[model samples]
Target: MKDRRARWYGGCAPGSRPVAAPVGARLLWRDPALWVCGGWQPEQVRTLALGSARIAVLGPCSATEHDLARALSAPELATVARTWAGSHTVVRLTERGRVEVLADVGAASPLYTVRAPDGAVWGSSSLALSSLTGGSVDTGWLAAYLRDKHSPASGLSAWAGVTPVPAGHLLTLGSEGGMTLASWWKPMRRTPHEASTALRHALGEGVRVRVSGVPASTDLAGMDSTTVTLLAAQCGPITGVTVHPAGVTTGGDMEYARALDVPGLIRSPFPLAARHLPFSATDVPLPATDEPAPSTAVWAMFADQLGTVASAGSVCHLTGDGGDNLFSSTPAHLVRLARSGHWARMFGDARDWARLRRQSPRPLLTAALRGNAYRIGRADFGRPKWLAAPVPKVSAPTGPDADMALVAELRTVARSAYAELQLADALGLALHNPYFDGAVLDAVVSAPAEQRYSARRYKPMLADTFADLLPDAHRTRAAKGLMVGDFHLGLRMNRRRVLGLADGRLAALGLVNPAPLRATVHAAALGAETVWPPLLSVLAAEAWLEAVERAPGTEWTRNAPTPAGAP
Candidate 1:
């Protein structure tokens, strides 16, 4: 019997209520051919059903029956979806014979689509889909993955015929057939002609909503006063974590953190030994995922903090990760002016910026001339010769300076979101970054360019946005601190493991040349200053491959379906 079954999966974390359909209890969910791996339930699944509308809110969300009803009844369901916030996916069956999905900014819940017998089936896990359809490796995706950056470039996964829905968009399949994809929220292209009064309220509420019942903690190092005050107000006297690097050259957010709290959770990693690898390295336990884990250093410092947070009875870790993007402006504003052929304005702005910085204006002019939209992601990630994959060209939208800024910010949001996801999954810790909220993005995008960066003021616009919260004194202190001692220490101690990882499945796949990869790892381990993203990516990918190949009843057959739109 050919089973044309449609099954759905969704859930939330911690307080999730477990629900499972008994085998053979529901035809749509019981088709053996259509379903596989009933054993792996990392978190209990939850489902909600309402009048002719079935909704499954998965993976830590505030998605409720009321929200679903509003979505089903409202003329603008996307708007209804927007008011709700969380790191999750809302998958629902409509009153009509239709299916729709709304995922948080850039597919946070990772709802991937796969080709099943009934037509196309959507689910939360790519591995589940691969097991169902006997899918194979996506070499084209591997080729694309070989290049630098970790932006959510597309809905494409590491397999063929599998795709994820993009962020801030709604995916709907109508009763009549075919998919209707629409954007509910577009970045505010230009600062509104009128000043937006919504930025502060939106941002404050954004911080408040991500809280769990447990006390939250965020790093004070490099944290802006706006974020600190907002978090303190919403979450109520949260502890802060600041890791001081252990070395002769020490630098971190510790200085600013001291101003925030006297006894904040200050930590210094126990120096790595030769046999010890980073907490996130291949030598450590790996999380199971359908796609390759991008290169990440979150675990480099964060793995230490997870234990402390957990011990303190904290339920979640808070971060102001997107503050810099949302609050500050770069010299790019000058370039935007030049690109628009406003020669006088560009020079004037450059001169003003130079005067404030106590430097020559010539460098600003030179940089603005060199400014471009290639989004030259991780050009720092060195290319290895083993993979002959062409880089995917991104067609960035050409528009006003404000739109460009929002686009750049969103691009950053995608990258950081992925990194945070990997870190949380690996550490088994919950996390919330208010700056990643949709409302915050809206607030930042609606502000005029003048507010983001002004020569006379230190992150003047950002400081002013939360003027009520940020102290007058703190507003003038815009200096940022950088830390790299941990990276050097972590890499130096893990060279052996790094070399061992390169010798295994990855080298056999020939996706990367082992020599350069090993050499890069070796040089970086010795603190020779080589590009790290590609090396870290290689480490994570190989570890993932090893885990996949070791699965009990599955083999990663090389010649799989080629995903459409892959490099």
Candidate 2:
């Protein structure tokens, strides 16, 4: 079977100006003002040239050539993206002689662009774009990353001058080379039943689009994965991979996975033992991704499962990533409710939430009133003690008032998943995350706020949407499995290597205070009260810097001849 995946880059130049193909990429198609190239087999790319317009939909696109031409007739990025059934990046030269690029809504296959002298150049890989622009890591962005690894710096890349085309937004270049962003996706308000129906349709279509008569695999542990796994089984044969803590007879995900007695389901259980712990192998080099992959920090834990999936001849692995972010609620919702004078609902939710956490409702309401969306605790308002310099202030993305916090969080999570996709690519497996699909998120968020979130019911909307397919016990289970013990054990074992990071690149760049960082690592190894996010963020940053420094030089761009009558 031909591989239906690709890594691509291209540029749209002014009339008759030439754009050179990047190194290691074969030119797929080229015209007078635009060029497309990729590292892919012929089956991976889809192209169409219609009246007064040309478009290239790269990476596993399911849209037919006729569909592309029809969408091109309208010449709107969002419309074109909507016409396409599968997740892919779109590069279109509009009839107005402007360039428009639409990245997938979930950013599962995001595109990055850099403004060139002639026009804007774009590629699937940020690192490649950085190399093309001769750019270095953006330390200011790094500062923001360290400050809030959970929330990515919106529209900013780790590499300077390389910007991610924000998810669901259209990147357009004017004739004279000016760039602009226009949002092409928005959640529509719908009744609870309408939203649920839309969600079910979107979810089912999302699964079917990826199932191409191939052996498929999925994580069958979490609520999201369980829902996805059972759905995939309905379409075709799929192996549901579940992990259970070795030597522990019960508890965690196995029980939930075992409950599903569906046909075409192959139960592939993997034992999570000491070998899969983080830092299990210190000598092995981590895969270099386009950005600092914090997921790589714990990649060892998933390697065995990936190997198992690979052995099963599964080409596409669907994960339930982005589901929790899509389905869960935050304190922001409470504040929104209070401002709207839904006082009774707010208090009820606060009381219910407080009961679950075994805390008083007063604190939750107080935190909401105070505009603290993260938590109601000893709020650390200033810079962290571990950082050596002041970080840049990152403003929240400006958007719809409803669930903007959750949207921001989901974008950040999707960016993280995008980084993890890089690692999966290195392993020669395509990671498909349907929950991150734009249509699915739109369907979920379109439901009334009350339907989307509830204190007494965990992911009430998600549970209700798939109630028939999922068991009540699996859907309503509030307890989540934590691998903190495994991580801490890794910390204990890799104490020296982690401590050495203090004297590493970040310390050299004055981004970290070695002494405090070392102290944090030491305390974490000893199972003391220590914050791991900052430590792990620093480690990821240091590892990225190390990888970037050691990576062999590559020229992603080369000079090509300008066309006749050009400047």
Candidate 3:
């Protein structure tokens, strides 16, 4: 929901004076040994207290008192947390004085832990925790992020000494200040038909809990958003917002968005003007994002859409961000089919895919016959030409090629989703992506690989599950909306602004070579087919550095104890 003052910081301190809430912060829940503080609205924070044990559920959740008690009494808390209806973070205090924090399955609701002399501290904002711990930027982590932007670095954040709780794991702190992460989740296994039923239920419940009798909004630009918009419409007053690019269009998103005919849904179409392009806001400081986000580089384009939603008083804004990663299958799925002795189906699918990409079927068949096509060895970590520093030997994904590829892609998309949430928060809007919910993810992953992909059909599983709700024009749509041209045009128009970053933070820190970096930016600005991810990553990191420097820091340390009621 829309809560501009959601920035919060809280932690447990053993044998230390109780901390007073920050001037503008609201006390969520407090005890002698633990305190949680944030600028959350009263409705946003739900708590259950029982003697020495207590639990708090933050964000949108369908958790009841019974659920909290059961979680507190259960041997493993994450199992129960996984069954919750909507996206949320769970903070629990045990009678034994151990504190546990469970973040959502996605990076958007990340929790960070920092060790202090007195006790262990945790907070939602890495920037907030960094200030209290006197943390500086972790250049090593930044380098790793640039090298493996798709697969997020485990157990590290942008701030030095700030450890993020990995997704699907619980962060627990012992009474003596020791910390550990316990495995609490795994993908569910089910047949395609069973998974379709489970997915419908999970996704429907997820939306129901968040928007029941509330004012909400959803993006109507793609299949993912269209489905979410339809669901939200069944509940209460809902706004369907769409942003159509002003310049040369790519896909039929604008057409489908305009053609939508929902009985009660309010359609709001925004045309993104030419001035609202990436790199146009290089002169302006961006929102305080924890890490480098490529989306932040293009924040200028979405300001109007987000601002308009916030102004309309919509509590929550939904997007279909994680849908592609969850539903779309890669070439590795073909490998699975070939290994299972489905020769006819494998060859047929390969031919269909080859025709779409304008390539011969020989390579696809060869790759499928080879089984796993991934390279996860140390040699896989190669330094790019623009990078000046020695690349670290980062850990690579293991297991089957198909699974590893999907995990890596999901993690990458989660990071971007989290970045968008942070930016939305800055504009007084709470952004939600239900597809990232653990249950929803499990439902998607549990389905058979063959059922999830088809070269001829577009997201067949999603389409078939919600076929009745989809428009006839969009149900069989195959083309995807592309922003490549818009991005190129933005760079060309603001070449001088981009060139100013040749000797920027990354170059000064010796991470990237100024000469090669400048050449890459120039070529990209001229609309050459340049490698976009690494180039955008460098620029994103540069912009993040500038933004963090401009933002004010918050301290989470406790205030001194009152002097025997002398006041």
Candidate 4:
């Protein structure tokens, strides 16, 4: 059980580690015995018996042992645990003859259990439970939910038999087969008047917190001093505070702020007074070279052409010898295809297929691609007839730098196009740059072909937005770091292992096209050219399917079982 939980938290493969914490601390209680192995935080494991119950408390400092005690006495023995501190807790409760389990408000940790016909329960993940109980994971509901929500959050992991203790909820498993799941906390609802007050208060306080720690010599850049005064006056009182010289990038905001050793504040917003600065459009030229175009130039040109089409209100269709067409003629079909392997494959290709092939597929890449494509294609084209063209080309300079320039040009073009179409009626255009959402031409150019085509990668314009908000030194600095990569390194260092529980089932289900996937992997390893987006998407989808198959209560049988007495 510990090994399984560890594998899941540590990421079974290269990128699968737990998002919250290490498996040992994640699964085992930091306190005394009641040891738990394999889970992320000790609080995720709970022991409940008739007379006493022990639980690991993982979460913020605001959530404490006293809070758990109060929850245990609540009507449903459910409590909302919000750990003010960073780490989540493991909970172990031993009663005279029974015990109950509850997760934190955020479900940041992992817990799995299995129940027998006679009411004995065991397992950490549904996959583990399915193995123990000869059951299958049920993912139909999960699939439907993801199709609607774009994520598998709703307390459902990839497997069935294993159920996640929902965020802000509690779960109780008895010696019998009966189980009870209940919500302990719900979103606070307020009247319009209250909401307005809350918003104003929150904004004022947030601003104050953001500015409180700045050195007196800190310049407001182009901002007006009056706006800062007004914001300070608006905020009644300041509790936790921190100062950031420049606004932080949306991606690095949290970590950057944390690294500063500040508390209770987020990235600073542009001062209202600063809005008056004449927004200058500074075009940074891409690296120039007199050398002739290399073999890779053709693909680069094609990508640049596609960016031009995207800029000019046309959806570009990406087709490889063996991959699915990324941009379809139909918007709805395009979305579906994008959701599958189309987008990821493109991103994989753009990031350099060889590198992508060596790495397992990342769903975040898929989401990023789909998101960028939708933002660029839908915003620029909007069901225009031009999208149907077999191959669209823009008569622009075919230099290596063209791709980057095209993206910058596209940003200006897209904003205008969207304004003309009144697309703002459907989507709100914020003061911050739209390129922040991974919709920039340079990001596409620098990315592998698959990634570039899929429209996922960090956009320079978005980075510039933060640059505009930060001190000149930090603003000009390159190298946006990633927390996940660090976490992945930690997991790999732990060397956690996962059993091949679903390999055979995955093969039989035809969930993934193994031959192409293997080929792509081999190609990547050998530094050979390969189509990335399709291959990645196929691989990710297959992995997801395998996860689904291993979930609890899922049955892959072709027919219903016969009656007990039937032959």
Per residue, candidate 2 scores C-alpha lDDT tens digits across 1-567 of: 423223445565444245555654555444423443322434346667666677777765557667777767773557656635455677787767777878776666767888766567777778767875775887777888787776566558888999888888887777666778888887678999999998898788778767657778998898999899988998999999888878764667887777889899998888877767775653435556677875656767666677568766887789898887788656456767766788898788888877877777887788667665544322233456788876676745432254556666676677767766666655656677888776677787788888887777788888999999988788788757777887788889878877777788877777888887888788889998666677678888887788778765446445454433322
Question: Tell me, what's the RMSD of every candidate?
Answer: 8.4, 3.7, 3.9, 21.7
Q: What is the C-alpha lDDT of each candidate?
A: 0.53, 0.71, 0.72, 0.29
Which residue pairs clash within candidate 1?
A: 11-58, 11-59, 12-60, 106-167, 221-253
For model 2, state the Cα shift of residue 475 in Å.
Answer: 2.4
Query: Residue 251 of candidate 4: its Cα lDDT?
Result: 37
Give a tens-digit lDDT track for model 4, residues 223-290: 11212223433333212112222455333333333333222222233211221111111121111110
lDDT tens readout by residue for model 1, 290-366? 65544344444455566556557655566666666656545567767877798997888778877766778876676
lDDT of 4: 0.29
lDDT for each residue of candidate 3 in 152-205, tens digit (9 for 90 to 100): 555578899887777777877775657788767666678888988988987887
**What is candidate 3's CA lDDT for residue 541?**
84
List ranges where model 2 is wrong by over 4 Å.
1-10, 32-44, 60-66, 83-86, 282-284, 359-363, 370-382, 397-400, 557-567
Residue pairs in candidate 2 whose N, alpha carbon or C atoms collide under 3 angstroms: none
Best by lDDT: 3
